[model samples]
Target chain A: MAALVIAEHNNQTLNEQTAKTVTAAALVSTPVHVLVAGENCKAVAEAAAKIAGVEKVLLADNALYARMLAENMETLILSVAEKYDAILAPASTSGKNYLPRVAAKLDVPQISEILKVVSADTFERPIYAGNAIQTVQSPAGKKIITVRTTGFKAAAEGGSAVIENLAATADAGLSKFDSEALSKSERPELTSAKIVISGGRGLGSAENFKLIDKIADRLHAAVGASRAAVDAGYVPNDYQVGQTGKIVAPNLYLAVGISGAIQHLAGMKDSKVIAAINKDEESPIFQVADFGLAADLFQALPELDQELAKRGY
Target chain B: MGSDNSMKVLVPVKRVVDFNVKVRVKSDQSGIDLANVKMSMNPFDEIAVEEAVRLKEKGKVKEIVAISIGPAQAAETIRTALAMGADRGILVKTDGEVEPLVVAKILKAICEAEKPDLVFTGKQAIDDDSNQTGQMLAALLGWGQGTFAHSLELTDASAKVAREIDGGLQTVELKLPAVVTTDLRLNEPRYASLPNIMKAKKKPLEEKTPADYGVDATPRLKVLKVSEPPKRGPGIKVKSVSELLDKLKEAGAI
Candidate 1:
C-alpha cells in the first residue's frame, strides 16, 4: 500500500504546503495518495492529482466535512486507513489538530514534524527547542506522521493520477463549528515566504508594527513577531514565533529589535540566513544571526527601506 | 446540570526550571543537567491548572483533578495546583525522561478509567519542547482537541475554546469530553496563598506507576548526544550607525 498524503485546501484554492507534504511523503514511500476531504473539494482533488509522484487522489466530499471537524475527519480517515501503509499530513494547524487522533485510533506512534526519514521506521525530528536532534524509531506498523513543510520542497506538477471519490462518515457529535476570525493578509504566509521580517518589543506598540510593514512590503516578505512583542500586545498571538508558537524556516529571516531568546530561536533557527538589528550588542539573537547590526531600529528602518528599494526589491 | 454530568476536569502539570533561570546549556551538550537547575511548575501548565480551577469556581465544573507523570518530586507541581484550588491530585511516578507517546498512552489509560469530561495540558513541556503529548492523548482517547488555547469558556454541554491559529484566532466549539492544551497567555495563574498551601497538604494525592495501567514508558527516541549549538563567529562592532548600514549592505542583510 502507498503512503497517503492529506491535502490541505479549501474547495476554491489549494495550499502549497500540500505539495511540500507530498515531497516529505516521497522520502518515505513511492506512489503517494493525496486525500482531499471537504465539501465540494473536487477542484482540490483534481489539482492534487497533478502533483509529481502522486499515484492517486482520494476525495471525500460531504456536508459533514464542510468545516473539517476533527471528529468527522478522524472517522472518515480511519475508515480508509486500512488501504494505506502510512498516513501523512502537513503540520499546519488543521493537520496538527486531526492527525494525532488518527494515529491514536490506529494505536500507532506518530512521528511529528519529521525532518527526514532515515529508514522505513527510523526518523529524525527536532527536540529541545531545535537545540537537539532526536532520531526515533517508530513501531514497525502502519505509520502516522505530520510533515513540516519547511524542510521539504513543494512537489512539482505534471503527473496523472486516478481520482477516487470516498464516502464521508457520520459526525461524532463531539464538536460544533463556531465562527472564525481569520486574519486576511495580502502578504505571503510566514511559513511559505522566502523572506521574513519580524519585530519585537522594541517596535514599541501595535501601531509601530507598520514600520516593519513598510520594509516587508518593499521586500514582499511576511511579518512576524517575537513572544515579547506578542505578550506586550504589539501583535496578535497569531504573529508570534517561538517554542509555543509557529515554526518558520525561510531563506532570509530579519529580526528587528528582537532580543533572541532560546525559545524564539527554536522557532526560526533553521532559516538559511539570520540577521539581527538591535541596539544591544549582548542580545542573544546575535548569537544565532549570521549578520548583526547594532543600531536603533527606529532610525534603521527608513534607511533599510530606501536601500532595499534602491536595490529594486 | 447539578447531577454527575457536571464536568470533571483534569489538568496535567510539570515541574521545570523557572523561566527566569538563565539556562546555560552545558558546553558538551550531554543534555541540560537539572542537578542544580532551579525548577518550578512549567509556566504554561500553570495556566492550564488555573483555567481548570476557574471553571470549577464558576460552577461550570464539578471537580478539577491535577495529574503529573514525573519523578516523586513532581508531586510539588500537583501540590501547587491543589493550593491553587484543585479538588484532588494524581501522581504517575516515573523516573527520568519518558517518550511523549509513552506518556500519552499512560495518560490515555488513566483517562479511560477516570473518564474526565475535559482534559487539559500545557501545549509543550519546556524541557523537551515536544508539543506532541496532548495531541497524542486526545488521539488515543478518540477525543476532540484544541491546542494553544488562550481563552476557554464552557456552556451547558460544550466548550468554546479560542485557539491561537497561524494568522489569527480560531474559536472552536467542542462538546464536553474534549482536550485543551494551553499556551502562556491563557491566564495569569494565581500565586498560592499560605492558608491554601496549608489546605493543599490535606488534599488526596494518589500515586501510581505506568505498570499500574499496563503501559510501558520506554523511549523510542534515543538522544545520541546533546550539544550546545555551534558558537557564532566574533561580531565586529561597526564604527557608527552609518558604518553599520554600510556593513549590512555588504553582508546583504538589509
Candidate 2:
C-alpha cells in the first residue's frame, strides 16, 4: 500500500501545496495517488496526475465536496481510507480542518506539520513553537499526517497517470457553508513566495503599511505581517506570518519595522536568507537575520525603493 | 440578536512558557528546560477567556467554565482564567504531557457532561504548536467548527464567524453548540486587576483526573529524539540602505 495525498485545490485550479504534498508522498513509497475531491475538479485531477511521483489520481467530483468542509471531507476520505497505508494532506487550513477528523474517524493518530520524514514511520516536527524539534515514531497501523508544504521541494509536473472516479460519500448534514471573505491579492501566495516582506506594529497605521507592499511589488514578493500588524488592523489575518499564523520559508525574507517575537521567528526562521531593518538596533529580529540594518523604516523606505527602482527591480 | 443570559460558554486554556522568554534546548537534547521557567496562560487562550467574559458581560452568556489539562500547577493557569472572569474552572489533572488527541478525548468526556452551548480554545498552543485539540474535539463531538475564528457574532441558532483564511477572511455560520478556536486578532484580553485576583481565590476550581472521564492520558506517538534547531550565524550590520542592497545583491538574495 502507498500514501494517498489529498490534493489542495479551489475547484478551478490545484494549489501548489498538492505538488509539495506529492513530494512528501514519495518519501513514504512509490505508486502515490492524488485524491481530488471537489466540484468540477477534472482539471485539478489532471494536474494531480501530472505530478511526477503520482501513479494515479482519485477524483471525487461532487457537490458535497464543493467547499472542502470538514463534514464533507471526513466522509470522502474515510470512504477510501482502507486502501492506503498512509493518508497525507498539505497543512493548509482545509487540510488541518479535515485531516484530524479523518484520523479520529479512522482511530489512528495524526501528526501535524511534519518538517522531515525520517522514514515511513518516523518524522520530525517542531514543538514549543519551533524552539525544540522532536523526532516521533507513530506506533500505529495507519498513519495520518499533515505535511508542512514549505518543508519539501514540490514534485515536478511531467507524468501521466490514470484518473479514476471515486464513489461519493453522503454529506454528514451537520454543517453548511455560509460565506467566505477570501483575501484577494495580485501578488504571490505568502507560503510559496520566493521572497516575503513583512511589517509589524511599527508601521503605525494601515495606510503606512503600503510602504511594505510597494517594496514587495518591486521584488515580486509576497507581503506578510506580524500578528501585531494584523491585530492593529494594518492587514488581514492571512498576512500574519508567525506561530499563530502561516509559516513561510521563502528564499529571501526581509523584516521591516518588526521586532522578532519568538512566535514570529517560529514561522520564517527557516528562510534561506533573512534581512531585518528596524530603528531599534537591539531587536530580536536582528538576531536571526543574516543581514541587519538598524535604521528608521520611514526614512529607509524611500531610499531603498529608489535604489531598487534604479536597479530596475 | 440572540437569547441573552442562557448559553453556557466553555473555554479551554493551556499553560505554556511566557511569550517573552527565549526557550533554550537542554544539553542532552531531550527537550527544552522547564525548571524555573515562568509560565503563563497561552496568549490565544487568554483571548478565548476574554471573549467568553465579554459574552457573559453582554448577557449573551450565563456561565463561563474554564478547563485546563496538565499537572497540578496548571491550576494556577486556571486561577488566572478565573481572575479574568471565567466564573469557575475545572483542572483535569495529569502528570505528563498529553498529546492533542488524548486531550481532546478528555475534553470530549467533560463536554458530554457539561453540555456547553459553545466551546472556545486557542487556535494552537504555543508550546506544542499542534493546532489540533479544538479540531479534534469538534470532530469527536460532531460539532460545527470555526477554526482560527477572528470574530464571532452570536445568534439563537447559529454563530456567524469570520475566520482568517489565506488571502482573506471566510465567514461561516456554525449552528449552536459549535467549537470556535480563536486567533490573535479576535479581541484584546484585559488584564486581571488586583481585586479580581483576590475574588478569583474564592472561585470554585474542581479537580478531576483523566480516569474520571474514562480517558487514557497515554500518548499515541513515541518521541525518538529531541534537539534544538540549527542556529543561524550572526548577522552582519550594514551602514546604509544602499550598502544593504549591495550586500543582498552580492549574496544573491535579490
Candidate 3:
C-alpha cells in the first residue's frame, strides 16, 4: 500500500501544487500515485503521470466530480481508501474542502498543512500562522494529511507512470454546487507567481493603487495588497495578503508603503528576496526585507519602474 | 433555515489570546506563555456572533446558542457571546486541551441533541489557525458547508453565500442544517452594552463534559516540540533603486 496524492487541477492543466505534494509524498513512500478526480480530466491525469516520482496516476472522470462538490469527491476517494496507506492533498482551497470529509468518513484524524515530514508518523506544521511550529506524531489506522506546498520543492517532469481509470462511486446527495464568481485575470496566479508586488494603506486611495500596478506591469509581476489596503477599499478583498488571506512564497516580493503588520508578515516572509519601500523606516516589513529603501511609494514607484525599464525589463 | 424568526442558529466561540497582544515564545521554547496574558474571544468568532445577532434583530432568527470547549474559564468567552444576544450558552469543561477533530466531534454530539438548524463558527482560531472544525463538523454530520463566508442571503430552504476564496469571491448555496464559518469582512461586532452584559450574567449556561456526549477528549497527535519561527537577518539599507536592483540580481531573485 503506497501513498495517494490528490492532484489539484482545472481539468485542462495540472496545478503546480500537485507537484509539490508529490515531492512530499515521495518522502513518505517510493510508490506515489496521484488521483485526478474531475470531469474530462484526462489531460490533468496525463500531466500528473509525467511528474517525477509518481509511479501511477488514477483518473476518475465523472459528471459528479464537476466543480468538485466535496461530497462527490469524498465519495470517490473513500471508494479506494482500502488500497492506500496514506492519503494526502495539497492544502489548497479545494483540498481543504474535501480532505476533511474523507478523513471524517474514514474515522481518522487529519494532519493539516504539515511543513516537515520527520518520519512516516511524525510531521511538523506551523500553528498560529507561523508564529510557532508544532511537531506532531499521528499513529492512526491510516495517515491523512495536507502538505503545505510552499514548504517543499516541486517534483520534476521526467517520469513515465501508468495512467489507470478508476471506477465511479455513488453520490451522497448531501450538497450541490450552485454557482461561483471567480476573478478573471490575465496576470499569473498569485500563489505560483515568481515576483509579487504589494501595496498598502500608504498608497492612500484606490486610484493610487495604479502605482503598484505600474511597477507590476513593468516587471511582469503579480500584484497583491496588504490587509489595511483592502480594508480601506484601496483594492478588492481578493488582493489581500495576510494570515487570513493568500500566502505567497515568491522569488522576489516587493512591498510598497506597507507597514508590515505581524499578520501581513506571515504571508510573504518566506520570499527569497523581500524588498520594502516605505516612508517610515520603523515599519516591521523592513526588519524582514532583504533590501530596504526609506522613501515615499508615490515617488518611488515611478523611479523604480524607470530603473527597471532602463535595465531592459 | 427559514427566513422567519423561528430559525435557530448555533454559534461556537473559542477563548484565544487577544488579537492586540504580542505572543512571546517561552525561553525554553516549550510553548507560548499564557501566564498574565490577555485572553478573549477570537475576533473571527466575534464576527460570527455579530452575524447571528443581526439575523435575530431582523426577525430572521429566533434563538442563538453559544458553546465553548476549554477550561472552566472558557465560560467568559461564552458570556461575551451571550452579551451579544445569544439566548443561552454551553460550557464543555475539560482539564486538558482538545484538538479541532475532537472539538468537532463533541460539537456534533451536542448538535445532535440541540437539533439546531444552522451552525456558525470562525474560519480558524487565531491560536492554532488550523481552520478544521467547521468543515470537520459538517463532514461528521454529512451536511453541506460554506466556509469563509463574506455575504450570506437566506432563502426559504437554502442559503446562498459569497465566500472569499483564494483568488476571488465564490458564491455557494447550501441546504438546511449547513455549517458556515465567518471571515473578516462578514460583519463588524457591536460593543456589549452594560445592560446586555448584566443580562448575560443571568443567562442560562449549561455545563457538560466531553464524556457526557460520548466523545473522548484524548489527543491523537503527540507534540514533539514547539519553537519560535526563524528570524530573518538584518536587511541592507539600499540608497537607490540601482543598489536594490544590483542586490536582487546578485541574490538571483530578480
Complex DockQ per candidate:
0.49, 0.72, 0.73
B22-48 in candidate 2: lDDT tens per residue?
Answer: 788889877779999999999999999
lDDT of 3 by residue, B23-124 (tens): 887888777889999999999999999999998899888999999999999999999999999999999998766888899999999899998888999988
* Model no. 2, DockQ: 0.72
Candidate 2 chain B: 10-residue stretch with minimal lDDT: B163-172
Clashing pairs in 2: A182-B168, A183-B167, A183-B168
Error of 2 at B50 (Å): 1.6
TM-score winner between 1 and 2, please give it: 2
Better of 2 and 3 by TM-score: 3
lDDT of 3 by residue, A1-313 (tens): 7999999998899999999999898777668999999999999999999999999999999888877777778889998888988999998777887788888778788888888899888898887778888888887678889988889999999999999999889877766667777777677888889999999999999999888888888777889999999989888888888888878899999999999998999889988889999999888889999899999777788888899899988
Clashing pairs in 1: B29-B226, B29-B227
Sliding window of 10 residues with minimal summed lDDT for model 1 chain A: A126-135
Off by over 4 Å in 3: B1-3
Candidates arranged by TM-score, highest first: 3, 2, 1
Candidate 2 local lDDT, A1-313, one digit each (tens): 8889999989989899999988888887667999999999899999888999799899999998888888778888898889998899998888887888888777677888999999989999888888889899998688899998888999998989999999999877766787887878899999999999999998999999889889999999999999889888888788989877899999999999999988899899999999999999999999999999999999999889999999999
Candidate 2: residue B245 lDDT (0-100):
93
Top lDDT hit: 2
Ranking by lDDT: 2, 3, 1
lDDT of 2: 0.89
